[model samples]
Target: MKKFDVDSKEVPIDILSDYILKNPEKIYGIHHNKMEELVGSVFKEHYNCEVHHVGMSGDGGKDLILIESDKSIVVQVKRRQSRSKTETASCVRDLIGATLLNGSRDCIFVSTADHFSKQSIKHKEDALAMEIIDSFELFDIDKFMGVLNLHTSEREKLWKELIEIK
Candidate 1:
């Protein structure tokens, strides 16, 4: 077992996993609120930013709004409900639209999908956000643990845990 941070404080992944597994209904409660809490928690914890969730009714293509210092970042969290490239590209298009609407050049598209299509990736590079991070890189403990400087045997544990929650 290895620790990961939740609020700038390190906590073990296995302990977190056990909590979710034992109280599966708690996962249901989180999903009802969408991943806004998860994304906001991570960003706020790691980046020291204030995050606001714009609800579904009129989100303007952005789900979470992050503000740090003078910089404001618009984030669109793609839930990976569909596995189609067209759908993924469409989400990219929405992020571009969000940039246009928000008048912010700094935008990000985060998704649970394994990866975006080349078209979506290019579109992200060209029109919309400057960054795209999917489940593989974001949740892979081995990869991200390097960023966090933590070593762990549960490489894909976060992904599996989040998917189970979802």
Candidate 2:
């Protein structure tokens, strides 16, 4: 199994997923807290802007955060591992309808998944005024393995995945 930066406290998946599955009605209540932080971190690095994660009710997500500067950004996060395009697109659709993202600078969909479709990117460019980035860009291997000496978590996982991709 692959390891993640245990440096960060994990959002409880079992409780969150179960709550989502059981009370599909109350999912926003359960995951908003955890999702916002992850998006805030991603936005800081990717967008280079100050963003906030607000857990607004009826936001239709686990994490609802805003990244703002000269212009505001609305982000909807899906904290799942790699999934099919259908699943990814679903999150995109919800963010659009919320109008929370409208008139804001940009709309973003953040995921733990390692992949996305070209069609998704095209739609993002053409229709949504958004962008889609995957885990690969977020977690590159060489920089991570640079700190490795002997079986380090970053070195081991990062190097192996980098080699496999090449």
- In model 1, the runs with Cα more than 4 Å from the true position are 1-32, 81-87, 128-166
Q: TM-score of every model?
A: 0.57, 0.46
lDDT of 1 at 10: 36
lDDT of 2 at 84: 31
TM-score of 1: 0.57
lDDT of 2 by residue, 46-157 (tens): 4567766665666554244455456655666554422332334445545555434354434656554445456554545544333331111211122212212122333347
- Measured with C-alpha atoms, the lDDT of residue 101 in candidate 1 is 76
Give the least accurate 10-residue stretch of model 2, judged by summed lDDT. 133-142
Give lDDT per model, in order.
0.53, 0.44
